[model samples]
Target: MTERKRVIQTGWNLENSYARLPKSFFNIIKPNPVSSPKLIILNYSLATSLGLNGQALQSNDGIAVLAGNQVPKGTLPLAQAYAGHQFGHFTMLGDGRAMLIGEQVMPSGERVDIQLKGSGKTPYSRGGDGRAALGPMLREYIISEAMHALGIGTTRSLAVVTTGEFVVRENQQLGAIMTRVAASHLRVGTFQYVSKWGTAMDLRALADYTLQRHFPAVDAGGNQYLFLLREVIKRQATLIAKWQLIGFIHGVMNTDNMAISGETIDYGPCAFMDTYDPETVFSSIDIHGRYAYGNQPHIAEWNLARFAETLLPLLHVNQDQAVKLAQEAISDFTKLYHYNWLTGMRAKLGIFNEEVQDEELIEGLLSLMQKYHSDYTNTFLSLTFDTRWDVALFGSTEFAHWYELWQERLGRQKEQKASSHQLMRSSNPALIPRNHQVEAALEAAVKQGDYSVMERLLDVLKDPYAHSTEQIDYATLPAISNRPYRTFCGT
Candidate 1:
């Protein structure tokens, strides 16, 4: 490529809508350049969706831009200011090492945030190195893509770039940066920041901007801020339900980590469950299991309650009436969450129609799985494909009775067996980002600098619902070890 061509950043189509907000909301800053930038992985599929030429993005200039060594034109990079209740402790926080470069307007006219994570420190570094490690960046890439393939709403990884520098953590780790794409970077914590520090006008402006950007469909005529809380509550209800259905433990559901867009935001200390244990805790710091596999729904409600608190002023002129409105919205969260979760569980079980006893039947199967330690993802896969698995567990007489009940439940529906099977196959993925497999892939890429394993893993994970033979190897469970699997907040 000619010097002139390389200098001209291609396919950016950027819009600085968020930067136009009040100065206190963000800091217009540029990324701290890295010495040498190398391409790790480029998401061509996602790139195409954003109207970017993947081939061009693989070029030297592209790698530089991704590594934060170069900023593309039309990009007014800014580090957003926000605060959060992390692990239930309120604190001030912001994009300490991340930058929201700009929004990319897709062919469909949808605007998405294109942020480079682990780029460098900003005004919110909090006296720490604003750098990221290769393992965590790749972890986010693998798991986020896996979540997308599994039909979950999540932030997408655009690319991962390795900076030829080391970051000091537990040990010296290779530093890297991740290109993340999201509907918007607005979070519940954004509201918290304005509510705590900014004036009521700032809070209202943030709420209005969030509604216009994300929940545009909501009627804005009356009590729109209240509607904003309701819309977010509903999205979060369904989002958490999806997370539960897939046995995903976010490990950290702090207010800052909860995106107002309802997309799964940070992948820190996040992992999928191998066994059917409700109290599974993977994050090393989550000793109390506040964000455990089963506690996600309640935690989501808690986060939404915090969000509702931020909107109390705008919800009504009277604090009492506002509290009532917020309480009503939060009260509906449990019903909405249960309804969404039950619907998802029914789909996973191949139940065409819900029955009054469906929850009982589902609970019975889960209890059996918990007692037998059946693999979560594969259990559903076995039910979907009629494949023999963990015969010792499936061969139990109690399981046989549950299977009979499930069959009877399915028979009640007018849908054919094939249609029911199809629903189950789609709802229950043939593969998930198994904890061991992800570790192996990350180990290979991080320590050995061999991305082939991760590449192969991503290839199969791209179509998690296919139930193809290629996924079997990826689907197999890891050997049981006495040591528990632990994930760290690789920030």
Candidate 2:
């Protein structure tokens, strides 16, 4: 018998749509190659979607390309320049430790950015070492993939590679690099960059380019910039509403981290809520709870406002008229966000129709969850199953009252009871990337060099809504000892 040998292809169909912009938009730079490149993981599913051969990508030659040791042919790499408002203060910042290697044009005609995060230092290093620890790199890989599975708009991870070196964080740790794929790296901060530093023409050119790339349906009629602003608001509204429905906290809501494409970018310090609390905050730097679970919608609108400011020059000829138009667009954010949030909340509660009392019922359940400190995901998941535990979970009388009201609401729906149950089941996930589980996975990987735990967690999270008796432990909440929890930015 003859053994089958694998064939490797080294060709990549790379494009540089972003590089076509003026030279001031970005700085061309090369990634600093690592000492010893080691493949941590390769997302075969994502690779296939990007029109790349997964088997070829895992080859020795491909691992070198992923680790910054070798650049793929026809790839033009550069670090993008953008300014952002960090914690309410504007500052000039860019791709400090990341580079856009190239754009992959999929077979379906969709284009996505291929970026190497934590690759090496560039002009935007900001006097810091351009490296990333293995733990945080793995965290982004796990959470970003989990987000995609949950049907949320987010940047996907293609591969993670170890640098076979050490990086200094709180202490020395193993260095790594993450390959991030996104619709585009354009951000609200990118607009702010041109608005603050570059000329008016630069801002207009960027707006036009962004429209052509992301929102092409919007014709360039009079006041096209204003139309662009409204479109961005709608995307951000829907994206943040999905986050809120799942009790996901973004942790860092800086303008730079908010992608103009409206997908969730930058997984630093992000965590899913365990107990139901509107004020839940896991990011250690969010001492003021500015970007807390409940504050996400408001923060999103604020970020969009900063984005709008960048387009003021193009919004209208007169400065005052531009401000008026921008204000009107910004004012629509709250209504759009509330509508999205309520729509998702209805689906989670198995309510298929609109009713004025729907908001009250949703708030009532949440208020009870907060009062009892009940598990958020579990409480919602339980709705799709037996109700015997509900009495004990939310207290006998309190849950009975809400349950009765909920049943009456369901009775009013035109859809059958079974259909509502299915809706609820699909909307509420049985498992999330729990903080304790994530920490445990990271610990095993960093301390014992074990990746099996992470692999198992990813397997369970891949089907978040499905209930499997054997994988039940992944749905459980963390012990009390893991309380008073906090997450860092991994800087």
Candidate 3:
């Protein structure tokens, strides 16, 4: 017998709550129509979750919408304006190459931003062409989906539409647009924009709107802005901790890139660490390693402090009292980060109970990983699944000692061995988007029009916790390279 199909329309339930805000928040504009619109990839799962018609989005009309060639019926396309601290210098920046079409209200009544990246130039284009290259768009799709699968807080990609044109980066590269879905595109820089140039009322209005949208639980009265600051700090603390736990490096952690929603925002120049070195840096622009693997927490705190500064006018009536409260809230970052990181690391090592030695045990393994140049993901993975330590990295005497301590600590916990093992498995993914593999997949798709590589990568990435045979092909160590691997922003 044949089964009936579930037909869905291409209609997206879009609303423009952001557009209702004062005009300073965004510029009302439509995306620049692309030359040719082709829907190369569609995340059917994400599409369905957003109450969209997955197949209908692949239709001619849908492809046009996805490629920014045509605006959807319900969306109010606009470009956001904000300022950010690039590197360490403060500068004005915004969605120069992107437009937030509108917010999609889902079945659960949750609102999310639907933005088209690489759509075209905006008033805040900053003298550069507002376009995106195929490779970077594909990279964000891969890494962001992989992050979501790995249970990390991140901005997700719903589709990738090729623009049948070329964007000049280092060389001529095929242009593409990625549909980025986020809780909202609110950022620390968003607050800074209003605080620096906007009037006192402007700052309060943005804060009140943000508080209601992102943190409605924050009390309406009685220092709600300070509460908002605290909430953002807490979310960012845990978010950075999760990134560190997964050996993921954000690469560019500018204030603008720091999402107020606490999801990892931009994916430019980002890569997962193969080796466990805390000092690992991959972005070609990060000559100083400001956004290195280990520095994520510090950068998050710094960004939060900048965010706190913006809330000072709303934090308290007395300037001194406000400063004290913000400072106090900011100081909790170290403790919050350490607690969150250690809690995650404990699970990665199959430990169910906390002890004084727990932090030391984790640091010991990390130190050994750095000393032996061990692969970060695989090191924990070996303990989670593999019993044998035949590999030279774990064969060292130091690792052996650490192993004994770990085992002893595991025994001391109340949970059964099976429970501990299960936790470890759930905590540590068997696979990550390895840098070399990701580059190869990007090259095949962008240069040769071969998508099978990316398809397989995405397949294995979907079920990262399970011991699937297909994952083995992608889980192996990245090929040794002649020089340091570098990633570009592809701006």
Candidate 4:
């Protein structure tokens, strides 16, 4: 077999961004050196898709590049600046602990941002060592991969490199860096950063650049800022709806965490629920329950308000007119989000068409699921074959009555029985990276040096909807005793 050669682009596009603004916006710095860099996990498949040789990824140089010990030939390392609302308090937060190494124009013609998480300190470091603990690093790798498998748009982990050092968090913890890939790391807070600095010109320039890059169709129009605002709202709503349907809690839904590209970017303090609870929260620091499961939609609206506020200056030629236009854009978010959420619920219930009472039927099913404390993913996946979701577990013969209601709603769908069944099965995943399973894998890797468990979990997570008898263990949720697995920010 001819050896597949590894390809590296010779130079970077080196596109300077908002960094052209005041120097206080961001502090430029290189990543800190690690004692011994070793690959804990490598996403070889993602590399191949980005026009890289799978074999070359196993090379020592590959580990060095991934560990942030050496920048790639075309890489441009810089920290992005942005402000975020952390724990309901507006805070000026930047890429304190993260660095955008550069942008890569993949063979597929898509430009992906190559970033290193836990790459060391920047101006935004806020008096802390910008290092990541092993548990949160592994959690991001697992959950981000799980999101991709669940057919959601998200940041992808390209590789994980251990620093061979300890990061002091809750206790001394292993340190690691995650090579994260995203369409763009531009967040809603990026706009806010410029807006608050009395730099409307930069904001407008950023908006134009963003529209051309992400929303090319809108680049030709008047009121393009409003167009970008509306489109971003739509995508974000759909993304949040998918998160809710999967029983995933983002834990931190800060405005800064909201990506303008509508991708799930930050994985800090994120967790998946084992039981159906509308108010479930898993981030140890989210004592206020602000970013709980049921509060996602409302929080989304709040973030959109922040985005709208940032865009108001460029949204309309007149200042007062701008506020009105932005308000109009913000208004579209709730309707768009609820529509997407309802449609997702319809598929979960096997209802494929618009019926006058479809929304009620969907709500009825959710109410029963909540009352019974059912597993979210399993309940949805099981509806394809059987609507009878463990009546005994529901603690009531009333589940039988609810199942009958579900059947009646299913009967109204436009698709025939077999087609609807196929649609439901395809849309609902049979597996997710259950919290317990992820914790178990992380424990083995961090404590026992057993990465095989994590490797196997990734394999199972890749084909989430597939029925694999051998991987039956992957389908079960964490036991009741392990119901709410807490996630953390490796502080």
Candidate topping lDDT: 1
Pairs that collide in candidate 3 are: none
Task: Check candidate 4 and list the clashing pairs.
Answer: none
lDDT of 1: 0.91
Give me the candidate number with maximum TM-score. Answer: 1
Flag regions of model 2 displaced more than 4 Å: 1-8, 388-392
Clashes of each: 0, 0, 0, 0
Query: Cα deviation of 110 in candidate 2 (Å)?
Result: 0.8
Regions of candidate 1 where Cα sits further than 4 Å from its true position: 1-9
Off by over 4 Å in 3: 1-8
Between candidates 3 and 4, name the one with more favorable TM-score: 3
TM-score: the better of candidates 1 and 2: 1
In model 4, the runs with Cα more than 4 Å from the true position are 1-25, 387-389, 393-395, 482-484
lDDT for each of the candidates? 0.91, 0.89, 0.89, 0.80
Model 1 misses residue 244 by how many Å? 0.6
Sort order, lDDT high to low? 1, 2, 3, 4
Model 3, 211-238: lDDT tens digits are 8889887656577887888888889989
TM-score of 3: 0.97
Expressed as tens digits, the lDDT of each residue in 369-426 for candidate 4 is: 7877888878776676675556654446666677677777777666788887877877
TM-scores of all models? 0.98, 0.96, 0.97, 0.94
- lDDT at residue 454 of model 1 (Cα atoms): 97
lDDT for 117 in candidate 2 is 90
Q: What TM-score, to 2 decimals, does candidate 2 have? A: 0.96
Worst 10 residues of 3 by lDDT: 1-10
